[model samples]
Target: MELYAKVLNYTMPVFLLLILVEQLAARRMGKQVNRSLDSVSSISSGMTNVIKDVLGLTISLLTYDWLVGHVAIFKINATWLTYAVTILVIDFKGYWVHRWEHRVNILWNRHVIHHSSEEFNLSCALRQTVSTVFDYFAFLLLPAAVLGVPVEVMAVVAPIHLFLQFWYHTRLIGKMGVLEKIIVTPSHHRVHHAINPIYMDRNFGQLLILWDKWFGTFQEELEEEPCVYGITRPARTWNPLKINFQHFWLLLRDAYHARSWKDKLRIWFMPTGWRPEDVKQRYPVYTIADLQAYAKYDPPGSSGFSIWAWTQLLVCYGLLIYLFAHLVTIGFSHAAVYGGFLVLSIYAFTELMDRNPHAWAFELVKATVGLGIIYWLGDWFGASQQYPWLTPLVGAYQVLSFFVSAYFSAAIRAGQPLPEAESVHQHGA
Candidate 1:
C-alpha cells in the first residue's frame, strides 16, 4: 500500500498536467470540454478512489497464488514474449469484467461513478468508484493464472493497463487510421462513454479493440450520430460520495419494495436498470426517454462559487499528499481520520457549488469539525513536526477558508448573485 501511494504521488501530477494540456488544446480548438464544478468533482472522485485503494479497502474473493498453484498448465519462462502474452490475457479479462459491470444491475454501482460526469474528458476518466469493496473479478484472470503467469507479472502490468486507458479519454484527438482498428483510441473510448442509444454499452475493451470486436460489443463512432455523454439516469449531485452509491441505494430500495420473492432475488443479477414491476410502477424513478430533450445537470452558480470549489479541492489535494507522504508515521487510524475529513470537505464544498438549499449548514458543520481537528492535532497530523512553518500556513488557510465558505453560504441563502455570478448569468443569456 505504501509503495502504491509513493507511485501515485509521482504519477498523479503527470495525469493532472495532461488534463491541463487537454483543456488548453480544447480551448484552442474552440471547444469547452470541461465545466468548472464537474471537473473538480471528477478529480475529487479520483482522490477518494486513490485513498480507498491505498488504504487497502478491497477484499479479493479468490487468491491468484492459489489459482497459479492449482491450475498451472504451462510453466512459461519470464521473457519479453511472456510479458506481452500476460498483457493480452489481462486485457481479455478486463473486457469481460468491464462488460459484466455494464450488463449486470448490482455491479453497475461499482462503475457508475466513472460515467456520472456529463462531460467526457480526461478528468472524467479519473472519476472512479469507492464502493467497489470487493475484487470479485479474480476468477476472470484464471486463464492467465493457468498459463503460469506469475503474480508479480500481474502486479507490474495491472497499474500500467489502468493508466494506459487514461490518454484515450479526450475529445481533442480524432480516430487513428490503422491504430483505431487495433488498439482502443480516443474515438473508441468516446463511444464507450456515450449514452446514445446506438453507442450505449458498447466498446468495453480497455487496451485492445479485439476483445470488443470478437465479443460483438464494438460500435464505431458515427459521423451521422454524434455521441451524447453521461448515463441515461443523471447523477444530479456533484458529491462523489453520494454519486458512488446512488445506484446501489436505488437497487436496495427497489429490492425492499419488490412484491415478488423471485423479483427480489433476480433483480440484482438482471440486466442494468431492470427493476421489479411493482417497484417500478410504485416508485417511478425518472429516466431519460428522449435523448434530444435531455439537458446536462448544470446548476447555476457564480464565478465566486467556482473559485471556492477550486480552492477547497486544492486544499483537500494537499491533505491527501500529506497523508500519502506520512502514511507510515501517521499509522492507519490517523490516515483513516484524515481521509474521512477530506471526503467530508469535498462533499461540503461540492454541495455549495451545486447551490443546494441546505449546503450552508453542512459547510458550517464541516468547518467546525475541520477547525477542531487542526486545533486538537496542533499541526495537520504532524506536518509541523518536520516543517514548523506549515503550522501557521495551514492555520491561516483554514481560517480564511471558513470565512470564504461562510460568505458564500450567506450569499447562496440570500439568493444575491455576486457581480461575477451576474456577469456569468448574463454571458450565458
Candidate 2:
C-alpha cells in the first residue's frame, strides 16, 4: 500500500473512534457532544485561517529573503537536549503569549473567543483565531527556524504538542491527583476556562503545568465549587465572521472613543471588557450564581444507555487517534494528519450548523466535503504510489463517515435535544 493508503488504514479507524468518543462524551455530559465537536471545528477554522496567513507570510518572507540570504540562529545538530529545550521554550513562549492574550485588550479580543464557550469539552481547545499567525508564528517558529531547525522537525513538534494538549480540554478525565500537582491536567485547565472570577487567568500552560505553578497562577479545582465554563459575557452570536472579529471590533471602538491618548492606550493594553474609571465593574460576569438561575434539565428517561453508548464511542475514537499517530510515523507524510483534521473540522462544523432543522442540507454538504477531503488526502499522501488497491480503503471510510454523519444529523434534528449541563445530572434520565 502507498503511504497515504497505509495512513488511511489507520486514519479511518481514528475518525471512527473519535466519533464514538464524541457520542459517549455527549451522553456523559447529558448534551449533544456538539459543544465539544464545535470546539474542534472552531479550532480547525482558526487553523485553516492560520495556514492561509502562513502561506501569505511565507511568500512575503521569501520575497524579503531575496534581499538577504537565508540566515538562521540555531544549528541543525539536533540532540535530545535540543528537542527537550525546543519543547520547553516553545511552551514557555505559548504561556506568555496566552497570558498576554488575556491581559491585553487587542489580543484578548482574539483570545476571548475561545473563552466564550458556555461549556467545557475537548473541542474548546479549537476555539482560536486563524489570523493569529502574525501574533504566534514568529514567537514559536522564528527562533527554531533561525537556529536552522529542520522544517520536518518543526512540523512534528507542533503536532506532538497539540496531541499532548488535546486531552486537557475534556471534562471526562478527573484531576490526576498527585500528577495534577505538577502537570496541566484537564481539571486544572477547567479552572482556566471557567467564568468564575477566581478561576480566570489561571492554568494557562499548553502541555506543562509548571508555568502556572512557577508564576503563581495555578489554582486547583474546587470540589465543592463547580467550575462554570465560559466567559462572563457569552458571545450568543452564531455568525462565524462576527464571532471571530467581534472582540477586535469592540476594542477598536473603545480605542476610538477614548478622549485621551493615554486612555486609548489603556483601553488597548488593559484586559478585555475593562472600561476606564470602572474599578469594580467587569463585563460578562458569568458566575456560578448566574448560571444556577437557569432552569435545570432532566435527561430523557433513556439516558443511562446513552451515556454508556457514548463512553464506548469515546474509547473507539481514542483508538482511532492513536492509530492515526502510528500511521503518520510509519509512512504517511503530514497529509494524513491534515486529512484527519479535515474530517474533524467537518464533524465539528456540523454541530455548529445543527441548530436549525432547515440547515439539514448544509449537514449533507459538510459530510460530502469531508468525504472528498478524505479522498484527496488519501491519494495525495502516496496511496497511488504504493498499492492502488488500498485507494478504495480510504474511499470506503469516507463513504461511511458521510453516511454516519447524515444519520446523526437526522437523529439530532428529530427532537433529540443536544447535550447541555442540566442533562448530565446524576438524578436525571
Candidate 3:
C-alpha cells in the first residue's frame, strides 16, 4: 500500500471513534453542547490538511527535489548513530521554534488561530497553519539536508514524529508517570493550551518533554488549579482567512506607530500587542462587577435544535461514503474525488446546522435521497450509454448540492438573535 493509504489507515479510525465519543460527551453536557457534526468535520478536514503537507514533503524527498540548502541542511549519513542524532537535533530545533511561536508577536499571529476556538478536542489538534510546513522545513530541515541525511531516513522519521504527536492532541489521556519526564504527554500539552498566567509560555516540546525540563520551562501538571484554555482574545467567528491574518493585520498597524526603527522591530518580534514606552495602550479588563453591569453578546442557551442538525449531518456523511465508493469503482481519481467530497461535505453540513435547525434533518435526508435519484437516473436511463457526458454532469451535480447545503448551514448559524447594543451617553453626542 502507498504511504497515503497508511496515513489514511492511521487517521480514519481515530476520527470515527472521536466522533462517537464527542456525541456522547455533548449529550452529557446538554444545553446545546459544543460537539456536533461540524466538530467532527473540522477534525477530519484538519487531518486532510496535515496529510497534504506531508504528501508535498514526501514527494519532494522521494524525487530528491528539495533545494540544495535544504538537502544539505537536513541530510543524514543513514547510520544508526546518525539516525539517533537526527532525532535529537530535529527535536531540539522543534523545541525552540515551538517556544518562539508562543513568545514572538509575528509568529503568535499565526499560532493564535489554533487557539481561537474555546472548544478543545481531538479536532482542535488539526487546526493549524497550512504554511506551517514551509516554516518548519525552512528552519528545521536545513541541518539535516546540509549533513547529507538520507532523504528516506528523514522521510520516515519525520512522519513518525508527526504521527506520534497526533494522539497527544486529544483530551482522552491523562498523565504518564515516568514517561512524562521524557516525551510530551497529553497532560503536559493541556498546560500549553491554558490561558492561566502561571501556565503561560511553558511546555514547548513536540515529542520530547526533556527539552522543557532541561531548559527550566517544565511545570508539572496541577490537577487542583485546573486548566482554563483559550486565547486571551476570542476569534468569535469561523472564517479561516480572518483567523490566519487578524493578528498579522494588527501587528502591521502597530509597527507603523513606532517612534524608532528599533521599537518597530521590537513590536513585530515581541509578544503581540506590545507598544513602546511613549505609547499608551488601552486595556479592556472586565472585572466581576463590570461583567455583571454589562453583559451583551451572552445568550442563555441554544434552542433544542442540535438533534435535527445532526440528523442532516449523518445523512450527508452516509452519501459521501457511497459517492466515494462509486467514484473509486468508476476509476475517477480518488485523491481528487475524496478530497473534494470531504471539503464539500464539511462546508455543507456546517451550513445546514446553522441555517434551519427544524428543517436541517429533513434537508439532509432529502439531499441524500436526491443523490440516490440521480444515481438511479444514470443507471436506469442508460445515460452513460446514451449521452456518455451525463456521468460528469452527475458528478457536477454532486458538487453543486454540496455548496447549496453549506449555504443553508451558514444561514442557520446567522439566524440566531444577538443581544441588543447599549445606548451611549457621550457628552458631545
Candidate 4:
C-alpha cells in the first residue's frame, strides 16, 4: 500500500497536467469539452478513489496468488514473453469484466460513476469508483491463473495497464489513422461513454481494441450520430458519494417494493436498467427517453461559489498528497483518520457546491470534525511538527469553509434564481 501511494505521488501530478493540457487543447480547437464545476466533481471523485485505494479498502473473494497456485497448468519462465502474455490475459479479463458491468444490474453500480458525467473530458475519466468495496475482478483472471503467470508480474503490470487507459479518455484527439484499428483511442472511448443508442454499451476494451472487434461490440464514431455523454438516468447532483451508489439504491428500492418474490430475487442479476414491472410503473425514475430534446444538468452558481469549489478541490488534493507522502510515517490509524476527514471535507464542500439547502449543516459537521482532528492528534498527522503554521491554517480553513458555505446556503434560502450564475444544475444560486 505504501508503495502504491508513493507511485501515485509521481503519477497523479502527471494525470493533473494532462487534464490541463486537454482543457487547453480543446479550447484551442474551439471545442468546449469541460465545464469548471463538472471537472471539479470529476477530480474530487478521483481523489476519493485514490484515498480508498491507498487505504486498501477492497478485498477480492479470491487472491491472485491463491488462484495461480491452485490452477496452474504449466509453469512459465519469468521472461519478457511472460509479461507480454500477462498483459494479454489481463486485458482479456478486463474486457469481459467491463462488459458484464455494463450488461448486468448489480455490476453496473461499480461502473456508473465512470459514466455519470454529462461531459466527456479527460477529467471525467477520473470519475472512478469508491463503491466497489468487495470486488470480484480476480475471478475473471482464470486464464492468467491457468497460464501460471507470476503474482509479482501481475502486480507490476496491472497498475500500468490501468494508467494506460487514462490518456485515451480525452476528446481533444480525433481518430488515429492506423492505430484506431489496433488500440482503444479517444474516438473509441467516446463511443463507449456515449448514451446514444448506437454507442450504448459498445467498446469494452482496456488497452486493445481487438477484443471489441472480435466480441462484436465495436462501434465506430459516426459524424451523423453525435455522441451524447452521460447515463440515460442522469446523476442529478454534484455529489460523488451519491452518484456512486445511486444505482444500487435504486436496485434496493426496486427489490424491496417489487411485489413478486421472483422479481425481487432476480432484480439484482437482471440486465442493466431492468426494474420490476410493478415498481417501474408505480415509481418511475426520470430517464431521458428522447435524446433529441435532452439537456445536460447545469445549475446556476455564483462566481464566488465556483472559485470556492475549486479551492476546496485543490486543498483536498493537497491533503491527499500529504497523506500519501506520509503514509508510512503517519501509520495506519492516523492515515485512516485523516482519510475519513478528507472524505467528509469532500462531501461537505461538494454538497454545498450542489447548493443543497441543508448543505451548510454538512459543512458545519466537516468543520467540527477538522477541528476535532487537530485537537485529538495535537497536530495534523505530523504536519504541524514540520511546518508549525499548517495546523492553524488547516483549522482556519475549516472555519472559513463553513462561513463560505453559509453564504451560499443563504443565497439558496433567499429564493435566488441561478440564471445569473455558472452551471452545475442543482439548487445552486
Candidate 5:
C-alpha cells in the first residue's frame, strides 16, 4: 500500500497536467470537452477510488499467492522473455475481466461509474468505482499462476497496465495507421465508451486489440457514425458516492419486489439492465429511447457555485494527499476516519453543485462534524507538530468554507438562474 501511494503521488500530477492540456487544446479548437461540474465530479470519484485502494478496502475470495504456490507447472526465470510473457498473460486476463464486467448484471454496477460521464476526456478516465468491495476476478489470473509468474512481477505490472489506459481516453487523438489494428488506441476506446447502438459493448480489449478481434466484439470508428458518450440511463446527480451504488440499489429493489422466486433469484445474474417483468411494469424507470432527443446531465450552476465547488475540491484533494503521504504513520484506523470525512466533504459540495434542495443542511452537518473531529484530535494527524501553524490555518479554512456554502445556499434560494448553465454546443452528436 505504501508503495502504491508513492507511485500515485508521482503519477497523479502528470494526469492532472495532461487533463489541463486537453482542456486548453479543446478551447483552441473551439470545442468544449470538459464541463466544470462534470470534471469536478469525475476527479472526486477518482479520489474516492484511490482512498479505497490505499486503505485496503477489498475482500478477495481466493488468493493469488495461494494460486501461485500451488498451480505452477514450471518455474520461469526472471528475464526479458518472462516479462514479455507476463504482459501478454496480464492483458489476456484484463480482456476477460473487462468483458465479464460489461456482460454480467451485478458486475456492471462496479463498472458503470467509469461510463457515467457524457464527455470522454482524460478526467473521465479517473471516474473509477468506490463500491466494488469484492475482488472476484482472481480466477482470471490462473493462467499466469500456471505459467509460474512471480507475484512481484504482477505487483510491478498491474499498476503500469492500469495507468497506460489513461492516455487513450481523449477526443483529441484519432486512429493510428498500423497500431489501430494491433493495439487499443483512442479511436477504439472512444467506440467502447459510446452509447450508440452499433458501438455498444464493442472493443473490450485493454492493451491489445487482438482479443476483441478474435472474440468478434471489435468495431471500427466510422466518420458518419460519431460516438455519443454516456450510459443509456443517465446518472443525473453530481455526487460520486450516489452514482457508485445507484444501480445496485435498483437491483436490490427489483429483487425484493419480483413476483416469482425464480425471478428474485435470477435478477442478479441476468443481463445488464434487465428487470423483473412485474417490477418493470409496476415501477417504471426512465431510459433514453431516442438518442437525439436526450440532454446530458448538466444542472444549473452560477459562477459563485463553480468557485465554491472548485475550492472545496482542492481542499479535499489536499487533505487526501496529506493522508496518503502519511498513511504508514497515520495507520489504518485513523486513515479510515479521515477517509470518511473526505467522502462527506465531497458529497456535500457536489450536492450544492447539483442544486439539491437540502444541500445547505448537508454542508452544515459536514462542517460541524469536521470541526468536532479537529477539536477532538487537537490537530490534523500531527501536522501541528511539524508545521506549528497548520492546525489553526485548517480551522480557519473550515469556518470559511461554511460561510461560503451558506452564501451560495442563499443565492440559490433567490429567484436567479445559475450563471453558466448554457452548453458551448446546443446539441450533442
Candidate 6:
C-alpha cells in the first residue's frame, strides 16, 4: 500500500502539469473544454478514487498469481518480451471489462463517475470510480496466464497501463494519422465518451484500437456528426460520491415500483438503461432528448467562489500527499481516519459549490469532527510534534472553512445569483 501510494503521488504532479498544458492548448485553439466547478469535481473524484485504492477497499475474487500458477500451459522467462506481452494482455482485459460496464445494467454503476462530466478535458480524465468495491474479472487475464506472464511483471505494468490512457482524454490533441488505426487516440476516446446515437457504446479499447475494430464497436470521429460527451441522462450535480451509486439507486426504485415479480427480478441484469414497462411510464427519470437543446451543468459562481473551490481542492490534495508520504508515521488506523477526513472535506466544499442550502450543515459537521480529531489526538496526527504550532493552525482552518461555507449558504438562501457564466455550446447527449 505504501509503495502504491508513493507511485501515485509521483505521477499526480505530471497529470496536473498536463492539465495546465491542455488548458493553454484549448485557449490557443479558441476552445473552452473545461468548466471550473466541473474540473474541481473531476479532480476531487480522483482523490477519492486514489484514497479508496490506497486503503484497499476493493476485493478481486480471483487473483492473477493464482490464475497463472494454476492455468499456465507454457512458461515465458522474465525479460522485456514478458513485459510487452503483459501490457498487451492487460489492455485486452481492459477492453472486455470496459465493454461489460457499458452494456450491463448493474455494472454501469461501477463506472458512472468517470462519465458524469459533461466536458471532455484532461481534468475529467481523473474522474475515476470510487465505488467499484468488488470485481471478479481476474479470470479475464487468461491470455496472459496462458503465456506464463509473471505476477510481479503485471504488478508493475498495471499502473503504467492506466496512466497511459490519461493523456488521450484531452480535446487539445486531434486525430493522429497512422497511430489512430493502431492505438486508442483522442478521436477514438472522444467517441467512447460520446452519447450521440452513432457514438454510443463504441470504442471499448483502452491502450489499443484493435479490440474495438475487431469486435465491431469502433466508431470513427465523423465530420458531420460531432461527438457529444457524457451520458444520455446528465448527472446534473457536482458531487462524485452521489453520482457513483446513481444507477444502483435508480434500479432499486424501479424494482420496488414494479408490479410483477419477473420485472423486479430482471431489472438488475437487464441491458443498460432498460426500465420496466410499468415503472418507466409511471416514474420517468430525466434523460436529455435533444442534445442540441440541453444545457450543460455550469452553475454561476462569483470569482470569490471559484477561488474558494480551488482552495478547497488544493488543501485536500495537500492533505492527500501528506497522508501518502507519512502513512508509516501515522500508522494504518490513523491513515484511514485521515483519509475519511479528506473525503468529508471534499463532500462539504463540493456540496457548497452545488449551491445546496444545507451545505453549511455538512461543513459544520466536517469541521466539528475535524476539531474532535485534533483534540483527541492532541497533535493533528503528529504535525504539532514537528512544527510545535501546526495543530492550532489546522484547528483554525477548520473553523474558517465552516464560516466560508455558512457565508455561501446565506448568499444562496438570499437568491443572489453570481455573475453570469459564459454561454456553452451543447453537444449530443
Cand. 3 TM to true fold: 0.65
lDDT of 5: 0.87
* Tens digits of lDDT, candidate 1, 202-241: 9999999988889899999999998898998899999999
Q: Which residue pairs in candidate 4 collide?
A: 298-425, 299-424, 299-425
Worst 10 residues of 5 by lDDT: 420-429
Which whole-number lDDT from 0 to 100 does residue 395 have in model 6?
A: 89
Candidate of highest lDDT = 4
State which candidate, 1 or 5, has the greater TM-score: 5
- Full ranking by lDDT: 4, 6, 5, 1, 3, 2
TM-score-better candidate, 2 vs 3: 3
TM-score of 2: 0.59
- Per-residue error at 15 for model 5, in Å? 0.6
Scored by Cα lDDT, where does model 6 land?
A: 0.88
* CA lDDT scores, all candidates in order: 0.87, 0.56, 0.56, 0.90, 0.87, 0.88
Please identify model 3 stretches exceeding 4 Å from their true place: 1-6, 18-34, 37-41, 44-48, 51-83, 131-147, 256-266, 273-429
Better of 1 and 4 by lDDT: 4
Q: Model 1 segments beyond 4 Å from truth?
A: 73-77, 418-429
Residue 60 Cα positional deviation in candidate 5, in Å, after optimal superposition: 1.4
TM-score of each: 0.94, 0.59, 0.65, 0.95, 0.95, 0.95
The digit string of per-residue lDDT tens for model 4 on 216-306 reads 9999999889899999999988899999999999999999999999999999999999998899999989999998798888778766578
**Model 2 lDDT at residue 380:** 27
- Choose 3 or 4, whichever is better by TM-score: 4
lDDT of 2 by residue, 1-429 (tens): 233334434434453356458668669878653533334334444444333332232222232122112656555656776687668767887788788888877788657767766667665665655435353334344555566665545445655665576567767778787888777888988899887767878898888899998998889889987888766655654323456676776667656665668877778777666765532233223324566674321223234323422432343243233334444443434534544444343334333343434334544564565456545565524446665754465455445444434443454668775544344343232
Clashes of each: 0, 23, 26, 3, 1, 0
Q: What is the lDDT of candidate 4?
A: 0.90
- Deviation (Å) of 161 in candidate 4: 0.5
Worst 10 residues of 1 by lDDT: 420-429
